[model samples]
Target: MRRNPERRAALVDAAIEVLARDGARGLTFRAVDAEAGVPAGTASNYFAKRDELFTQAGGRIYERLQPDATTLAGTREGPRDAARVTELLREIVGRISAFRTGYLALLELRLEATRRPELRDVLTERVRADVEANVAHHLESGLPGDATSVRLLYLALNWLIVERLTLPGVFSEEDVRRLVADAVERVLPAVTRPDGPGPS
Candidate 1:
C-alpha cells in the first residue's frame, strides 16, 4: 500500500470522531470516509481492517489529547507542592473538557478491547507506557510521588475523568478540583525541610 501520512492521519481522526459519536459498532470505513468528507472507500485504502482502524484511532487519540507544551512547562516551573499538583490536575481536567469527544472515544476503545485480545494487548502496553511516562514526569518535576503514589493518582484521576465524561454535571469543575487537591495531598508524600518544619 502507498504511504500517505496526511491521508492516514485524516482517516484516523475521522475514525475518532465516528467512535465518539456513533460508538465502536458504528465505526466503519464508510463512516470514517463520510466523517472526513472524502470519497467512499478512502478510509479502506488507508486502513484495510477494522482492527487497524481502531488501533490507529486509539493511538491518535492519545497523541491528540496529550497536554500541550505550555501546560507541561507550567507544571515544571511551578512550586512542588500540593497546590501545584492541584494545578496540574486542573490542567488535565481542562484538556478532558476540551476534548470530551475524543476522550469518550478513548473510553469506548477500552471497553471494546475487552473482547479483542490483540487489541487488549496493544492497549495494555499503551496504558503502561503512559503510566511510566507520568511517573517519570512526576519525579522530574520534584513531585512527591513514588511509582505507587503516581499510579494511585493516575487511577484516581482517570476515574474522575471517566465519571465526569460519562455523566456530565455529576461533578462540577470545582468539585473535581477539590477532589484532585485531596487526592494529591493524600497520595503524595509531604515535603519537609531537613533542618526546618514540615507541612502541618
Candidate 2:
C-alpha cells in the first residue's frame, strides 16, 4: 500500500530540504520523517534504503535542470540578448550560489555512483546528453560540428562556474561575465560577430 499522494510529495520535499540544509551525510530517514511529519517507518517504506533516497534526491535536481536545458536547447544563444551573455552568466552564478548545499549533495551522489556501476552509467549518459543538448543551443554560426570540442567547451564552462563560488574573491560577476563573453567572442568569432566585424 502507498502513502497518500500529498504525503509522498511531502516526504520528497522534506528530503530535498534536508539535503539543502545539511547535505547528504545528514539525510537520515528519521530526519526526513520528522520533517515530513510522518513516522520513521513511513519514510523507510517510501525509500527502501539510503541509496534510494539519495538517488531520488538526485532525480529531483535532474528534474529542475531539465527545464533550464530545454529552454536553451537547439539555439546558439539563450532567450536573453546575446549582448547580455554576461547578465545570463551572472544569473547562472547566482542561481548556483543559492544551491551550494544541494550541489554538495550531488557531488556526494557522484562518489556513490562510482561504487555502483549502474548509477555511474546513468549519470554519465545524463551528463553527455546535457552537454550535447546545451551545446546545440549555444552554437555560433559556422561552428564546426566537432563533437569533442563541444564536449570540452561544456566541461570547461561548467567547471569555471563551479569555481566562481569555490574560489573566493577571484572576480566579480561582471568581470567573470565579460571574461567569458570576450573569450567566446574571440574563440567563436564567426558565430559571435555583431552585424559589424569579427574580432580584430
Candidate 3:
C-alpha cells in the first residue's frame, strides 16, 4: 500500500526535531514514532534504514534554512539596493539566534556523515546547492571576480553567527547583524567594482 506523503513528511520533521532536541545518540525510531503520533512500524515502513531516516531528517532541516536563504537569493537577479542588502543581512543574522541549535544539529549531522559516505553525499549536494544559489545571486547582480572570496564571505558570516550562539554575553543578535552587515559592505564593493564609469 502507498503511504501518505504528508504523513511521511510529518515523520521526517519529527525525526529532525528529535535529533535536534536530543542529539543523534538520543534519537530513536520509537521517539520519532511518538513524536509523529504514528505507530512505530509506520516510520519504519517509510524509512526501512536508519540512514534513510536521517537523510530525510537532514533534508527537512535544510528546508527550514531556505526561506532566509531565499532572502539572499533574491539579490541574484539584479544589483541589490543598499536597503535590501542590509535587510537580507539582518534576517540572516536573526536566523542564527532563533535557530541556533537546529543549525548546530546540522553541523553535527555533517560531521557524522563523514564516516557514512551515503549520508555525506546527500548533505554535500544540499550544501552545494545552497552555496551555489547564493553565489549565483551575487554574481547576477553584477558582482565580478573572486568567487572564492565571495564564497568565503558566505562561510565566514555563517560561522560567525553560529559562534555567537555558543557563547554567553559575548555578543548580541544586534552585534551579529552589525558585524555581518559591515563584512558584506566590505565585500560588496569588490564584487561590484567598476569596469568603467556607468550610469548609477
Candidate 4:
C-alpha cells in the first residue's frame, strides 16, 4: 500500500466524522472517501480492511479529543487537593463537551469492537493504555488516589460524557459540574479535612 502520512491522517479524521454521524453500520470506504472529499476508493487505498480503518479512526479520535496544554499544566501544578481535583475534573468534562463529536465517535467504535474480535483486541489495548497513562499521571501529580481510584474516576467520567453527549438535556451544565465535584470528593478524599474523614 502507498504511504502518505497527511492523506492517511485526513482519511482517519473523515472516518471519525462518518462514524459520529452515521454510526459503525454506515462507515464504508466509499462513505469515508465522500466525507474526505477525495476520489472514490481513496480510503480503501489507505486502509484496505475495515478493521484497519476503524482502528485508525479510534486512535485519531483520541488524538483529537485530548485535553489542551493549559488544562494539563493546571493538573500538574500544586497539590492534588479536593478542590484542585474537582477543578481538573471539571476541565476534563469541558474538554470532552467541546469535542462531543470525537467522543461520540469513540463510543461508536467501542460498540463496533464487540462484533470483531481483532478490533475488540485493538480497542481494548488502546483503552487500557489510556487508563494506565491516567494512573501514571495521577501518581506523578501526587493525586490523592491509586490506580483503582483513577480507574473508577475514568469510568465515571466516561459514563457522564456519554450521558451528556447522547442524551442532551438529561443533565444541566450545573448538574454535571456538581456531579464531577461529588465524584472527586468521593473517589479522592481530601488529604486533610477539618471535619475529619471525607464524604462517604
For each candidate, what is the lDDT?
0.82, 0.62, 0.70, 0.83
Evaluate candidate 4 by giving its C-alpha RMSD to the native, one decimal. Answer: 2.3
lDDT of 2 by residue, 1-200 (tens): 37576776677777777876776678898999988887768888877677777666766666554545543443334443434444444455566666765555566667778786765776777677777765664444334324554565455566666666567478776667777666555444554555634322
Candidate 3 contains a number of clashing pairs equal to 1
Runs in model 2 lying further than 4 Å from the true structure: 1-6, 68-91, 139-150, 189-200
Worst 10 residues of 3 by lDDT: 191-200
**Model 3: residues >4 Å from true position, as ranges?**
68-84, 143-146, 189-200
Candidate 4: residue 78 Cα off by (Å): 3.5
- Highest-TM-score candidate: 4
**lDDT, ranked from best to worst:** 4, 1, 3, 2
Q: Which ten residues in a row have the lowest lDDT in candidate 2?
A: 73-82
Model 4 lDDT tens row, 64-127:
7766778677778875567777787888888887887788888889898888887788788888
Ranking by TM-score: 4, 1, 3, 2
Q: For model 1, how does the per-residue alpha-carbon lDDT over 13-37 read when each residue is reduced to its tens digit?
A: 9899899999999999899999999
TM-score of each: 0.91, 0.69, 0.79, 0.91
Better of 3 and 4 by TM-score: 4
Q: Let me know the TM-score candidate 4 reaches against the reference structure.
A: 0.91
**Model 1 C-alpha lDDT versus the unseen true structure:** 0.82
